[model samples]
Target: MKSTINTSQLITLPDGRSLEYIEYGDCSGTPVLYNHGMPGSAFEAQVLNDVFKDNGLRVICPNRPGIGRSSSLSEYSLSQITQDCFFLLESLAFNKVTVIGWSSGGVPSLWQAKHSHTQISQVILLSSYSHFAELDQAPSHFAGQASVLKQVTTRFPALGLLACKMAGYLLKYMPSLYFKLLMQHCHTPDSDIIEAHPHYRDMLIEAQKQSISQSASTLFMDLLIQFREWPFYLKSIECPVTVFQGDRDPFVPERIGQHLADCLPNAQYHLLPGQGHMYWFEKSFQYRLARLCQI
Candidate 1:
């Protein structure tokens, strides 16, 4: 179970399902469980690969159900995902960890702080949301191919699955154009960053392809649940929490991050002005993330 930089493995859970994960950083360093965003897979955790190693941190990036190599679940709540995380850590002999959630991943990250705080030292949310209702404020901002998929999946389950299947087909056969439209719709800052760093865009496409190929149901279910009311409230969580968001991130507005921070009794909010949703791709941001976890 020793960690190795950029190594991938699969652990079988008690329910006969497998959890796939990729590890980076020092094998014996403080364990940091990273939760990736929507339509993203474990590979997204490698954004700060070198920073984690330099900071003496062990980062574990696991694929949620129906994503990557992980098995799918027909119906599961956000809390159930938290339980999956606990089992994954226990199997690896990790009693406690620092949980870091990015974007949609933040839902379970908050849940961990509330339901599994006993085994969580700290919680961090990057461009994340505290509730689904927050998205109502900027519906136009989320209008895109992504929004179409969500709407289809939520309103017509059968059609949603078909849409995911077709999308997956396109991603596999026509990846370049698929990513082209994706980046074309991105905010100026986000698109600029991705253009400057081709690898980031490539990573995104690869991860997304893997996600849809595995089982689009998981992605659809995630989006559907995200549109409804979350089970827990931010004010109820007592663990130390930190929220980082880009001031110009329309999908997860700066105000939403600030609002979540305000509701949490022990939380701090850091807004990166002018930056878009993918500010975490910056080295400086990665360094700050490492420092925050270590502290």
Candidate 2:
């Protein structure tokens, strides 16, 4: 398939589920697969796509199951999302991939190392927690923490849409106001030069998993089953693993990331001071990515 700037390509999972993926740059070049954080859409890949376009690498970012256009299954788990990624790559004729997973996407990246290490040259996990205890260190701002509040309105599966509809309105409207006030909390803002775009957040709400209630419940379930101790089953992986963390990441703390890097058999960890969990859009992040991938 030819690469397009912002175009999305559809790929089907073995279960006949259609997943949404975006590709950028030359298809024949070294393929770098991107996995985004939870409740995030592939739109988040846009910045990185533009930055790495001429770097002789093909970038691919896919929407996870139950997010965006991807089909959701009742039996979905973090491990299964990893397997789904494996088949998606195979279906797309991706023989080998250098994976860069962010935040929640790190779970599937570990899954890749565990089950498909032979097909991956290098693995990168960014701003992700390797253990359940790490959750305690997450800043109060992570929306996943608010997922429980969203789920309370949808206790009954049948009336899920109503709850979702209500939650969506609040999330869509509140974030804008919050960002305005909280911009100073993290970094100094240059409103004149940079107009912040919450495009991915908009796309997330417009997804087929449109119901905030359902998505929250599904994530709640994933956290319940996964998000702890790197699953230990990831022992088979021998590839060089790189864990990226930000000094002030609201979701990932330094100690937790250090623990994860120490646990990996062959791993290198990089700490980006003054950067937060969403490092993809930062200029400093681009340089770090270049250095990490040796582009």
Candidate 3:
């Protein structure tokens, strides 16, 4: 399927950076900004294209700095990331918006809520982790891959970057094999969902290619920052927020979601019995979100 993004809509930032974003759904509908996960790009929005369109929602998915066509940032911080998003929204003539984050994408969504509560109508996190520091006690199987990377990156930055390069290269150049291995690591619920809906797998592969093709370092940078301590606290966010977690998620434990829900000043936690990390890609996701939006 053709992408919903218009190249003509690309905007230049004050720092000479480019903000590449794609629009989906009704042109005159309510606005929502989707913050994609690590190793993702604006193309990630394609997975939810039909959902947004049917709901009469205007969705904007942007490629973060160092990903896709956007310029790389020398320094990375959650605060700066939120500010950049604010600038992009303002430039697009949008003020109030619903922000949705998935996986690692939750970092920015939470930061945006903390920094610009008045501008954000609501915040939603899908299979997200609260922070890396607090994940010490999470499942060892889930932390194993990340822990190795964090350790290597802390000890040898060059080697860490090379590892990321190799991983991204495999993802972009050898996607079929890469995804096969990736599926092996997923929980049963997520694997079943992907196996049933082959198109969803294609979407993930394409998003990875789009992101890595632009900058292999982008994923590495995201990982480095993800392991460090976050600048803000979950309790600081006063906006209406909801966290959707899957009981079978292997990447992020259910306990993390429950803890975050407990911490957020105003947040609700919804747990799905047999779902997993990729539940957001399911067709029924739109209806679930619609029901929540009505509340």
Candidate 4:
């Protein structure tokens, strides 16, 4: 809740959008740029930032274009987000950096691998799919589950909005509930991570509420756009890539992660046991990242 970390001012994007990010650890350290998942804030990887901080590795997490104190892009696409992040990297003068993308955030990372592979030293994707259509495999389908988001507005619009607003309030106070819900929805076991960090639950919830205002349809569309002929991009990427997928992931079937690993020429694939999308932000993620980065 209270942060002693002093974050610099927001960085403006080429599209006139502003992104808020936190920078910490030694500036001379190797830069590790982190992108958060959909409906998540810059704080989504707060736990990972903490984990990687002391190792002389610089960590950067922007507000992901819209969530916390960041400005929204009038027209958004994963390519544009990746370009913006590339500019940010240029501004920082980090000639090369490692990229870590988690879940929906992996879209932009994938874009980078396809379009800006030269700038990347390595890419680490967690619980990421090769294409967007994989959303059908995702465990939590707000569309199929309840359509509570769409139906509530018609049935009890006022109460629905109020509940969303309240949910936002509760988020700031109860981050743990958020993480638990995410862990549950991920439909994968994370007992090792769970036993270690109980407080992450509240942090995760805060992240969800922070970006909850975004339309669900638009979020779904993001994956749709990414899915259509997505494999082509994988074939084009020449950089070193690594993927960590949760075998039990209800959202992305293990088949996809397997197919991707087999497709990429320089990819190292790992099917993390009893994990899911949340693996990216968990402490366990470090082992994978460090191994891939050769740190």
TM-score of each: 0.89, 0.75, 0.89, 0.75
Which lDDT values do the candidates have, in the order given?
Answer: 0.79, 0.63, 0.77, 0.63
In TM-score terms, candidate 2 sits at 0.75
Comparing 2 and 3 on lDDT, the stronger one: 3
Stretches > 4 Å off in candidate 3: 1-8, 134-159
Residue 128, model 3, lDDT:
71
Task: Report the lDDT tens digits of candidate 1 across residue range 129-207.
Answer: 6664544453343533435555676678899767666667778899898888766666899988887888997888888
| Candidate 2, 87-127: lDDT as tens digits | 87887788878888777677777777777746787888887
**In candidate 3, where is summed lDDT lowest over 10 consecutive residues?**
1-10
Model 3 residue 248 distance off true place after TM-score fit, in angstroms: 1.1
Candidate 3 TM-score, true structure as reference: 0.89
Q: Give me the overall lDDT of model 1.
A: 0.79
Residue 207 shift from truth in candidate 3, angstroms: 0.4
Q: Give one digit per residue, the lDDT tens place, for model 3 in 1-295.
A: 2224334257788888777788876667678888988777777777766666667677888878877777778885566677789998898789789999888888788878888946788999997757666565445424434456667876688998997798787896788898988888798989888888888888888887876776778787776777777766677788989999888877776877877787788998999998878988777887687555534
- 94-211 per-residue lDDT for model 4 (tens digits): 7787888776666677777777746788888776656533433444423322233334544565665565556555555665664555466555365455557777665666566657
